[model samples]
Target: MLGKLLKHEFKETWKLPVLVCVLVFAVFLATYWYLGNIPPAASEDEISMAAMMAFLLFTIAVICGNFALLIYLAVRFYKNLYTDEGYLMHTLPVTPRSLILSKLILSSSWMILISFEIFFTIFPVMERFFQLLSTDPQISLYTALGEYISISEFVLLVVVSVIISSISSMLTIYASISLGQLFGKHKVLASVLCYIGFSAITQIITSIFMTPYMVSYVITLDTTTAAAASFQFWEFFRTILWIGVGISAILAVLCYILTEYIMKKCLNLD
Candidate 1:
């Protein structure tokens, strides 16, 4: 039953994310083209500077596509399971847990796919882009990044961050939309408010608790030695990264339970 739900959900949701991925790759190709055509004196030209700004916007667009995908799916969840259609859906033999699991798994999978997409889509162009501006012959992405951390560590960080953040985000959205079920009218507005409230709360948590601790660790690092400072800074960065990951995991679980409990208690077919 879970397998069937996953397949159905994927078929329904795949088109938009797939289209977003295609558009991201299209933007990447344009970036690659611009990088390949740069003349030695191009950096001096105002037109080239404008093009660089456009390139950065293109990279930002690639990332924004991920958010857009999540937003669309969030809406889909609310409409399918909490709106007029939900009565039929709830009548199905599938358990609510399985239904939620299917959506979570698919959302996380697409996010991971697009995370790697953004990384690889931009990675090949990074070396060329930096080399065009950098004076050092030894300047490569690996060497530049190696100053702070090893290439392996950076990759691991990206992967871990992607996985944890995606799941956390999906569960948050699910929980927020689920919360709307408790409201009698203007459920959509209620969901939006719930999402905003959750965002604010999480921001407060990081601002008040996690970020200060991370900043304190970085500020306390020994400054006499440049090498040691870099190591310690990134080490603290990783420490904060894991702490954030733990918080996200906790948030995800809480949201999951919140969603299930709300569905069981307050779900209204009327």
Candidate 2:
């Protein structure tokens, strides 16, 4: 039953992400070709200006597209489970828990997909542009990034961070929307307020929780000492990554529980 629900949700929601991905890739390809074809004699200033413009445009589009995807997912959850359509949805034999889980899974997957697309798509283009600008034959972006840490460990940490953070964020939005359904009217407005309130609270809590670790990290970064031992830096950062993963997992679980309870008990489709 949950599988069927997820399939239906994916079918309904896939078009938006597909369209976004196509548009972004098209723009990136066009920009990459244009930048690549710039004449050898083109002045440094001209090349720099063109590259900067392209970078800014692509960056803005990627950022906007990612936000739009998240907003769409949030809106879809609210409409499917809290508005008129929810009447039909609730009549299904599926449990509220199943419905919420399906939505969370799909939403988080889409967020992770977009994050990867942004990273993979923009990174190579930017890397090439910088390489061309510097004309440094030995420059390898990937190698430079992996210099301070084990590549496998860094990649594992990144993947975990992205998945956990995306799930946490999606669940936060879901919880907010569920809470908003309690309002008799102006539910949309209520949802927006709830999102803002949740975000602010989360930021405050994260800041407080991370401050001590951050302070300790800074204190350890004596250039002379750090230069003598780079492994210490990797260990410190790995510890930070684990801390973030733990926090995010806890938050995601809490938000999931909150959303599930609200959907099952306080659901107001009135």
Query: Best-fitting candidate, measured by TM-score?
Result: 1
C-alpha lDDT of all candidate models, in order: 0.81, 0.82
TM-scores for all candidates: the values are 0.89, 0.89
Q: Pick the candidate with the highest lDDT.
A: 2
Pairs in steric clash, model 1: none
List model 1 lDDT by residue over 1-270, tens digit each.
Answer: 999999899998999989988988888888878776774234433245644665687778886897898888888888889777787789999888987898899988888888889888787677767766655546788675688877887888888888988899999999988887778888788988999999899878866667677678767878998888878877887777877787788888999999988777777755
Span of 10 residues, lowest total lDDT, candidate 1:
39-48
How do the residues 87-202 of candidate 2 rate in per-residue lDDT, one tens digit apiece?
A: 99999999999999899889899899888788778877787667656645577777766777778887788788889999999998998888888888898899889989988887
Please report the TM-score between candidate 1 and the true structure. Answer: 0.89
Model 2 / residue 3 / CA error / Å: 1.7
In model 1, what lDDT does residue 155 have? 83
Candidate 2 similarity to native, TM-score:
0.89
